[model samples]
Target: MKSNRMVLVFFILILTLWGCEEEKANKEVKTHGAYTENNVAQKMDKEDKNNEKTAKNQDDNNSVQYFIEEEDFQKFAKKGLNPFGQEKKQINLSSTDFEYYIHGMTHQKVKAKEKWDFFEMHPKRIKWLLEGLEKTKYKLGPDKQKYREILKRWKQKDFSTIVEDHNFIWDENEGTVGKATDRLSQEDEREYLESEYEMMHHFK
Candidate 1:
């Protein structure tokens, strides 16, 4: 009888220990699941904040106001004088627009082998354009750095290397140096300029 009672006691003790272990395992599983859920929530919150920040930055960039408008460029181009001519009306252009205008003007001048007399005659206008560029809201990078240097040189009344500058831009645009302006005949160049001017004014 005592032996049976001892066996019964041993069985009861075993069941109690097994129950405690199962409860401990269940608690550990719940804790792990809670930790995983918290991690997911935290990760989602971080991603949402990052997306909001990126969207805000895009909005800010899109909302930037430029000093020059397309209409202003059209009016300026219609006069058929050198873009920097002394007789032309003064128009302020943002840095970005100034860069575009300079490229078009320089390309035309180089193709036509025109004199740089406009630079000499339009000192005040050039100074005003440079000032407008200087106050632009956009950040200047390496490419724009070249424009800045050109503007500074022009401000100092030095346009001796404008042909070299034109070639540099030409090469930068992936054009062959040997065929920079040589490949285009006078008639071809004029046609190309007319098409380019129409496309620039109308498409934008």
Candidate 2:
């Protein structure tokens, strides 16, 4: 009976030790799982913050910075109106205003009997317009480079084929001169101008 009691005690101790080891193993597995899940959550949060920062930076870069007031820019867009007057104030022009000024000059060139008359009559006006364009910050890469080339030409006072250049641009984009006059209605002309403006500057 003593031997039987010793065997029973040994078996019970072995069972107790095995149960303790099993419990410890289960606890370690639970702790490792929790740690892994926390790490994954922290990684996701960091990624979300990085994405938000990138978006905010892009918004700041894309926002337009104007050189002049909105009202003054609109005033410069009026047909047949020259922005540079006899009494010259401090010249402030935006990229949009520069394009509008070009459009007005082109219209004047088309109306004048002598092609070079407008350039001759308003040399100071032309000079101021060019200076304003040089000073203005351009939003589009293509437009900036294009105007730079034109500025180089105009600075040399070489406008021999300006009318041809105007006609070619109009013809290639919209239609022939005859089509513009006879076929295009007033609405069509307005739409064309609006489309052209949007294409050039990516703004309305």
Candidate 3:
């Protein structure tokens, strides 16, 4: 009987120890699982924030659409092709439109040898040009008086005589309108760059 009692006590002790070990193992597994879940959630949250930032940046970059309008060009056209007309009837173009216009006309898309380079600019640039007459600036020099007479003659024929024609006017004033294209002056270059940067980044 004494040996049996000792054997029973040993068996109970072994079962208690096994139960504690099993509970400890289960608690460790639960803790590890919670940690893994937390890590995954944090990673997902970080990715979501990055995605939002990317989308916001894209939206900021594409906020403004640069395109010329026919009505605006027509308004500029009503001011005539001469320097006075150009100065008085300046086309209200945003910086983007101006950039597109300047690049679209001068840059050649095709090879250097090609004479007929494609005008692969935005369709708006073409629209403003096809409307007949581009925006220009007035000059304060001896040419001003000369331009005044030329403009008078241009208006005399109900604006029918195209100054672009060499035969339409004096040889000196033949390409005068073409020469006086409206461009951002040297002083405005810095302003344009700063505005462009701000528009892209939304900087203060």
Candidate 4:
């Protein structure tokens, strides 16, 4: 019986030693594989930051910046704004500017078939345009020798060529420019002025 008791105690001690060795083995285990979660998250964060930076750079690239002085910028803004061209304000501008602006306004208004609905629905803009032309005549052109000689004796209101009964007078009732306002577009103005090239000979 004593021998059997000793054998049972020995078996208990072996089991205790085996449990301690297993615990130590578990503690000593070192992982040898790659770091998966943290490394992946860090790489994704870097990629996200790079993508954000690239998008920001692209947005900056899309902006156009022109370097110019304030006066030049303002002047450039005004370039091509006036479609009438410098011929309208030129020193030696011909009579065509006055006649063309007068008639061109009619061309713009006559297309508006429904706004006024007058006898034939003529636009009031045409009349406003004619009045503007008459007002602009007071604005002087280039003081060239030919212009000076012509205006010396012929005032804008009295010239037969400019104020003739069939052109200058605005007959809204008749839808016409009377005698002085007969000259039409650039082409018509050129041809009509050529008809009076003999009158211009005296100025020469």
Candidate 5:
């Protein structure tokens, strides 16, 4: 009987140890699973934040920045309208700067096709410049007067009238100067006229 009791005790102890080991293994599995899930969640959160930041940066890069100074504006206003080159170096300028270069700088004869491209690329800037010319006050001068009349026609979107006046200027006729405005009545028109007009007589 004593021997039987000893065997029974030993069997119970083995069972208890096996149960404890199994419980410990279960706990370890749960901890590993939870750790994996937490790591995956953290990784997803980090990716989302990175994507948001990238999108914000892209938006900032897409924004447009154009700057124009008074000296540049005056230089352009005096130069009258001229042809702008079709090179990327020219086109890469901001819309406002592009206008200054086209109207302010002198260039060799520009093809009608190139002018058309400029128009197509910067219609808004051109319109804004034309409108500004109509409203801004200028010093007393004939050149200023002629430019005012040209701006008037341009504001009306009358390309034909501009061409006609340009022709008159080409013919060296004083009559091309429209009715004198309060501004620029005292200054000579010679200063405003382009020294070298290279545009074709008419756009195609």
Candidate 6:
């Protein structure tokens, strides 16, 4: 009877060991599968993020919408492009606008190839151009008759139907208007960036 009892105990011990081995093997297989799946998911997520960023940058590079409203341009011209008015009789311009304008237009008069090249490499550089337009200081009597002539040219140059090369240049008008354009300036862009930057800091 004692010998039979010992045999029964041994059988139970063998069964327990087998059960443990099976459990361990199952755990290892499940763990490895889960790890592979996670790796693949992470790679796909990163790829998607990169694609989104690229799309956003492309949009920003071409953000400018061309052509000021013809009526608005005329209104600005009628205002004599001068902030100080005719009574003040003195022209004051910020250094930022004056320096940038000549350099920006220098492409037209001196280096057409270089100007075109600049736009090809970095289109966003022209984002600051509208601002420069707002920065121009109006001198009295640029050419009243000439201003009229340029206005005619601007009206004639509208390319509502055409595509490509729809450039809007300063009308060669001698209006005593305080400014050539009512465009947003670099200062304005800077201010907006700063405001947005400050607003975003808290999220980080």
- Count steric clashes of candidate 4: 10
Per-residue lDDT of 134 in model 3: 35
Q: 1-204 in candidate 3: lDDT tens per residue?
A: 999999999999999999999999999999999999999999999999988866754553344233334565567567664121134223443333332333323222111221221122334443443232334332234533433443343233211222232222223423332231233332343344454445545744
- Weakest 10 consecutive residues, lDDT, candidate 3? 109-118
Q: Estimate TM-scores for all models.
A: 0.35, 0.32, 0.34, 0.20, 0.32, 0.30
Model 2 / residue 45 / CA error / Å: 75
Of the pair 1 and 5, which is ahead by TM-score? 1
Candidate 5 off by > 4 Å: 65-204
lDDT of 4 by residue, 17-87 (tens): 99999987766553212456657889999999988866754553344121223454345347732223222
Q: Give the range of the ten consecutive residues with the poorest summed lDDT in model 2.
A: 112-121
Q: Kindly give the stretch of ten consecutive residues in candidate 1 with the minimal lDDT sum.
A: 114-123
lDDT of 1 at 194: 66
lDDT of 5 by residue, 93-178 (tens): 34334333333311112111112111211234345444444444433245545555654554443333333443333334333333
Model 2 over residues 72-148: C-alpha lDDT tens digits? 43465454344442223324465445444444444432322222111111344556666665565545445655545
Model 2 clash pairs are none
**lDDT tens digits by residue: candidate 1, 175-201:** 543323433333553555565556656
Compared to the true structure, candidate 1 yields what TM-score? 0.35
Best model per TM-score: 1
* lDDT of model 2, residue 149: 54
Q: Relative to the true structure, how large is the alpha-carbon lDDT of every model? A: 0.55, 0.49, 0.41, 0.39, 0.42, 0.39
Q: Report each candidate's C-alpha RMSD, comma-separated, in the order given.
A: 18.2, 18.9, 21.1, 26.4, 20.6, 20.1
What local lDDT does model 1 show for residue 27?
99
